[model samples]
Target: QYLCAIRPKDGRLVLSTMVYADEVNASDDIAELKAVSETELPDKELKMARQLVDSLAGDFDAERYTDTHRQKIMALIERKADGDTGLVEAPEAEAAGEVVDLMAALEASVAAAKDARKRHPTGVDEGEGEGEATTPEKAVRKKKSA
Candidate 1:
């Protein structure tokens, strides 16, 4: 078999890959990319990016997060075998909100994040303990204190 992951010599593998997104305007060279820093980014964009990351940041609950479609399909198969169609109808999904512009998407994300926080104040599902929540601000503060 070909070794795509680990190298026996160093016990590590390096990766070089491009992102799947064609919309993102990325520079050809790493040097070109490194030339730009957060300071150079517009205040609005930087702030939104920070907010987006902060809001989305959380410990993923393996028990909760899963491939719902696959689960549904399996359940559907079971139901079909048992001569029943137990709630496996394909549900309507929103159209892929393809990014026409990055800034607009960022703004929408910020708004959505705020709304999500409002809905789940503890950043987890209802009745869950606060131990699951981890904000970037809190983590940074903790590190500084330590």
Candidate 2:
């Protein structure tokens, strides 16, 4: 396995590559790579950014997430195989008026996110309990309510 970090330099991106060996060797390799890169490049900002990144490094966990879109696609395939038509009209896209103030939009987004967190403390919807499948209508209603 290999870990790579990309940072913006000038007008492009520069990648710092490091190979992963054993646990001990991986840390040594990363440190050596960083040292070599830092010595070759005399950019204080990049050096500081690299140091900050190294300080925040942690183990990679792959099992903590699920691909909902892939799951939904497979479910739809199964339904079609079972003689279901599986036809649904796509929702109309809402027109977003011109965004004049980026700061206000960002602030509104943060406020909305905080409100949502308070509404759903567990980060799960009311009817989204384990093994309790949510239908399209239920999903639409939930979004409308929100």
Candidate 3:
């Protein structure tokens, strides 16, 4: 809403903003407001107003947040001291010849399914394989299927 002071001689109305939608019954110094209404407000006055609001409503608490990574590192160091052997697997390097050929074929098949939406005009979706089995027995079965 606007507070309008209309001049009777002319049709023009002098408009002044009263309050914002979010600010419910916000307090202001009437004397300073009246003074500024006639003149211009200074940057020092604006900064002081912001400082007053922050002093009344803002809470400064540092202990509310905790460092999770530091805690995890400390726990891992303790486990290392106790001689705990974690199940860490070494990454396999790229294979050569026939192995590379088979890997390329599998990758191409997967790519075809993933990019089906882009290739097909009618937008027919295709599903992906849920990877090769984990156990040795299942791995053997998977190799037999290939």
TM-score of each: 0.23, 0.32, 0.24
The lDDT for every candidate, in the order shown, is: 0.50, 0.57, 0.48
lDDT winner: 2
lDDT tens per residue, model 2, 90-130: 87999998868889989999889856854653454445666
Candidate 1 lowest-lDDT run of ten: 3-12
Q: In model 2, which range of ten residues has the least summed lDDT?
A: 19-28
- Provide the lowest-lDDT 10-residue window in model 3: 5-14
Off by over 4 Å in 1: 1-10, 14-65, 85-88, 93-146
Ranking by TM-score: 2, 3, 1
Model 3 pairs in collision: none
Name the lDDT of candidate 3. Answer: 0.48
Q: Tell me which of candidates 2 and 3 scores higher on lDDT.
A: 2
lDDT of 3 by residue, 1-146 (tens): 33322211121122233323332222242333444345556779757755655565433233444456567778878888899889545659778655467888999998888687445444443443354222322323335553
Clashing pairs in 1: none
Comparison by TM-score, 1 against 2, better one: 2
What TM-score does candidate 1 reach? 0.23
**For candidate 1, lDDT tens digit of each residue in 1-146?**
21122111121122222222332233444454343332366679757766765665444323444555566789778889999956645769989975598899899998888679756535754355655753343333335553
